[model samples]
Target: AWCCGAGGGVKSAFPDLALWTAGQRVDEALSTGATVLSSACPFCKRNLSDGAGNRNVRVTDIVELVAQAMSGRRMGLT
Candidate 1:
């Protein structure tokens, strides 16, 4: 697992850097052939989703996945 780069006010103080960091992490995830990246933090989700822009990967929260599962809905990016 990697830091989503939105922690410690990085997203607010250094948005570009945070995005770059998240992109790097996303690249690592893609290297693993992952189609989805899940996080428990809303900040992480937001940053990861932004970093995954135009990429064939989905960034979502664990709660969302759980909700989808409970609701019998197909899991997907909203």
Candidate 2:
């Protein structure tokens, strides 16, 4: 897992910057040939999800994915 750009006390004052940071991280993920990205923090998940909108990738909290798995729902963790 990696940063989602929602930390470092900047998200509250500079949401745009946080999104920009998340975009960078998401770009890195795209290069890895992965389609799914997961993080444990809610803030990270939110920022990452926002930055990754409609980018052929899925961002989610790992705990949610585990719950989905236990419920037999179709999901991924790439």
- The CA lDDT at 68 in model 2 is 89
RMSD to the true structure for each prediction, in A, is 1.7, 2.6
Per-prediction TM-score to the true structure, in the order listed = 0.86, 0.81
How many clashing residue pairs, candidate 2?
A: 0
* Residue 14's lDDT in candidate 2: 93
Error of 1 at 43 (Å): 0.3
Candidate 2 yields a Cα-based lDDT of: 0.85
Candidate 1 per-residue lDDT over residues 2-65, each given as its tens digit: 7989999999999999999999999999999888888999999999999998998998889978
Give residue 74's lDDT in candidate 1 (0 to 100): 83
The number of clashing residue pairs in each candidate reads: 0, 0
